[model samples]
Target: MSPAKAPAKPVRILLAKVGLDGHDRGVKVVARALRDAGYEVIYTGLRQTPEMVVDAALQEDAQVIGLSLHSGAHMTLFPAVVSELKKKNATDIIVFGGGIIPDDDVEELKKQGVAELFTPGTPLQDIVEWLRKRFPSS
Candidate 1:
């Protein structure tokens, strides 16, 4: 008889709060939800710089990088993280974010290569499904 195959590894997600934003409740909630949904989450606490976030993602070998920005600095911070990841040849790391971001800014960020932006009221299930669909196990 043929042997059974082992299960694939869980997806790793890196969640961070970049810049001067100290409010982390939202990120924490998302982190917990992702963990409960079976994703390995690495949350970098508040006041993290763009470089720091990208470095953590690289070190953790995360497949997704989710930023929770409530300080209205998504424009600068998101692009900075994307830029840093590009610099390190890590553009394959999916970049997404959520916060008090305006609609116009969301379009701009997407144009700049942000995979997606989840605003307030976005369901945790939605995020979970999205990740699962895109990064399904081998």
Candidate 2:
């Protein structure tokens, strides 16, 4: 008889809106989608700082962080989140984001340790599928 393998832990993701961006409808929708997809999601709500996002993720023991931004602060805020994660020695935590970011900035963010970027209008299924592949339970 084959030995049974232990069940994998549920993928936990922390979703946050950093900087002064107050719009949160999109992030809330995403949180619901991720939750439905079986990911344990933590929503940090609006106007969070990068430090706050990282602190929450650490406290929650999240494996990923999904940032939502609309204040044109991708250049500043996204990198700040990445930097804070590095400082916390939590570089294993995957980072990704979506918003009205420009193509050029998307590449820049990816180069700066963001695992992925989803611009507005990308399907939510795409995000869920990416996570499924990135962190398969099997």
Q: Give me the overall lDDT of model 2.
A: 0.92
What tens digits encode model 2's per-residue C-alpha lDDT throughout 1-138? Answer: 895543468888999999998999999999999887877888878899999999999999999999999999899999999999999999999999999999999998999999999999999999999999998771
Give stretches of model 1 more than 4 Å off: 1-7
Leading candidate by lDDT = 2
The TM-score of candidate 1 is: 0.92
RMSD values for the candidates in order, in angstroms, are 3.8, 4.3
